[model samples]
Target: MGESVKYYVLLILRGMAMGAADVVPGVSGGTIAFITGIYEELLDSIRKIGPNTLKALLNEGIPGAWRQCNGAFLASIFGGIAISMVSFARMITWALENHPILVWSFFFGLVAASVVYIFRQLTSVSWREIMALAIGLGLAVFVSVARPVALPDYWWVVMLSGSVAICAMILPGISGSFILLLIGIYPVFIGAIESFNLPLIASFLLGCGVGLLAFSHVLSWLLKHYHNVTLALLTGFLMGSLNVIWPWKQILETTVDRHGEVIPLVQQNILPLTYESLIGLPSQLWPAIGVMFLGLFLVLGLEAISNNMSRCE
Candidate 1:
């Protein structure tokens, strides 16, 4: 294949990885983008989709606007993300249901490795950076542990949830679906996807469009002006998020869903032995540990390959 085709194909695979991560409650697609070495480019492309691109389309025409906004790259990435979400949603949900420990363990390793990767991005650490890290860590921990708030299942509510969730989805440490869960709209959003409810999905997508455009600008500005502090904070966010993905947890509370099904609401982390004793189920400890290492090594391997590719370039 030509170099251009090869590059686009890699972008699509990265997008698929991002989509897969976004589906999980504690994984961030932005984290995938960051680790894959495309986070800044992704943000810049999204930020380009505003007034300048519109003017180019109106005045300079389609081809001009496409070049201005990096249309081909955006299209390839989004196409992959859409395909992965639509195709893999059911499969991921099934895995979560049947093999929760393994699924969580794998992502747990991803996030833990990601924290180290992000931390190493910093050139120097100082007291101010340490404070920023602490703040980010504390905020993520608070949000992760907070109780879910019940929201009315209205059209507007769904839109609002999408807006909020999309913003979280793009942040390195935050999970958009987890945000939806905290707002009590996760099941509603997932149902729309699984059932192919066009109207509902359209509303959510509209919200996502608005949120992505607005948040991208802010993130781009922050990265430009305060790169180190922001990286530190993001690293802390990833560190704090590890609590959510930890494999061994005991449900502390349950709530009835819209379908009148009981589901876990609040959970507390526990030792593997404690999980076995209290939950009275196989903790699956050894398998989970093995999967965690697999995830860690996967990230490390990807990073090494990326470095080699950069050197070749």
Candidate 2:
């Protein structure tokens, strides 16, 4: 017996969800992978994509190399992510620009539910795991609040930022886009994307490939040896990251980009009514809450389906 086509389709859908999450600044594709019940397998698959696969290709042929690299799964997942990022990028960008609070509110619920789901994976709540969770939480908060540091517009710097940000992107709680923002290169990258600068795009993507390969190995090893601590730390990362996506926020400062577009440079979460009063905009409190529940139930529903499938297997 083998996996049905339906299984692969589901995997693609899961990948799409991860892609959608990645498009949001405060959310993570890795967190989406974790909540969708494929975190370990995804890590393992990424870790296996290395030099050995080439040797397998020479010795055992393309199929052998593919098997060694788990090509089918990677292809399905990455393909779906590609499709989704392309399809949803415009829509999400529009939503965030026009309905920022509502958009963030939905993801707020999604990530909140994710914290509970990931925490439930722990078999026990020991002191060591507790410490790990605290550290992860602190790190997430620090990163969320950190001010942007502007680097020179150099190619090597772009590559370095890509490598470092890619590491954060794959981590469960961190946001690669937000990390880029904190690095003060997000707008440049966006400009490149808009202009289709092949050289810059290639540099960044090359960095991403290198970083993903390197970090996946380290993360896979950590999960294998210290599952409890790592899982707990990841759960904490999710908990702390809620600050990044809080629905109501007060903009403390704004900056003008190279394109002359103004964007938030500093912000702090605020209560809904306080946000309305301070920002002089409708908090849309009821609509925000409803969307939050929608996002929450969506994750729960997916988790239930995943659990049922696991039992069937």
Candidate 3:
């Protein structure tokens, strides 16, 4: 019993790490899962909750279906994610508001290390794989810099946003919330969460369910058949995502939110000295660099531990 409790607790901690990563704009929960050695398992579990599992529920009963779907594992991981999102939403928001540069610097380092880590997974490199990497890198860079579209507040739009965002959530270098922000529904979704808008939440969740089921199957298939190319592409994605998280930036455009607060909409990356000269901000160069190193080492340490455990097992 104690062993069971201990195992589940560890799962919860992994989920928490995922949740924290998801909260960051340029980070991905899937990155956490990958680092923690649960990426494939998580994908498999998600993929199982489809037609076969439903059929099992009807034919063999709840126990069989639950077992087939790995219900306990899913529950533990998702429960931790939910808890972390709810618990840290406001705190993360506050941190972003007050310490944007430092926050971005940390995630920037995290993703830079992630690119190297993911790249090492490739056993061989080919021209086609290199092309795939370029494509992925281009796509990520484009998405990172693309301007936000003003989406309507309609239910369908919200649902579509959720569907798309959840896909990004599961990708190693793409961020779901950042996708939402790009589509101009991030504030609305955040507001919905804060207000407990049941209908909006339901619609969004429905979209997420559909998206996750569909995307996981496609991803699982690709990983099974074309592992090298896929990893190459994902590594490229991490490489391009660095542009999104660069620490020093100048806001080129701003928009008024619902609260009438001016929020940065478009930004240009700049050197620390340039940022100081142009924006007249303190730049916080030393602190940001320190945090960046902390994030880099954190990923390295986790990778070392994961490797050690694999060897022991």
lDDT of 3 by residue, 1-313 (tens): 8767876787888898898888777788988888777888899899999889999999999999999999999988988887887777788889999999999999998888888888888999999789989988998899999997768778889999889998999898888888988888888887777677888888888998899999999998888899999988888878888888898989999988777878779989999999999999999999999999999998899898778766865
Better of 2 and 3 by TM-score: 3
Indicate the residue-level lDDT of 231 in model 2.
Answer: 96
> lDDT of all predictions, in order shown?
0.90, 0.87, 0.87
Per residue, candidate 2 scores C-alpha lDDT tens digits across 231-294 of: 9999888888998999898889898876689988999899999987898999999999999998
TM-score of each: 0.98, 0.95, 0.96
**Model 1: residues >4 Å from true position, as ranges?**
none
Predicted structure 1: clash tally? 0
Q: Write down the lDDT that model 2 would get.
A: 0.87
Candidate 2 residue-wise lDDT at 58? 92
lDDT of 1 by residue, 195-230 (tens): 999988888888998999999999999999999999
Q: Find the candidate with the highest lDDT and give its number.
A: 1
Ten residues in a row with the worst lDDT in model 3?
304-313
Q: Judge candidate 1 against the unseen true structure and give its global Cα lDDT, from 0 to 1.
A: 0.90
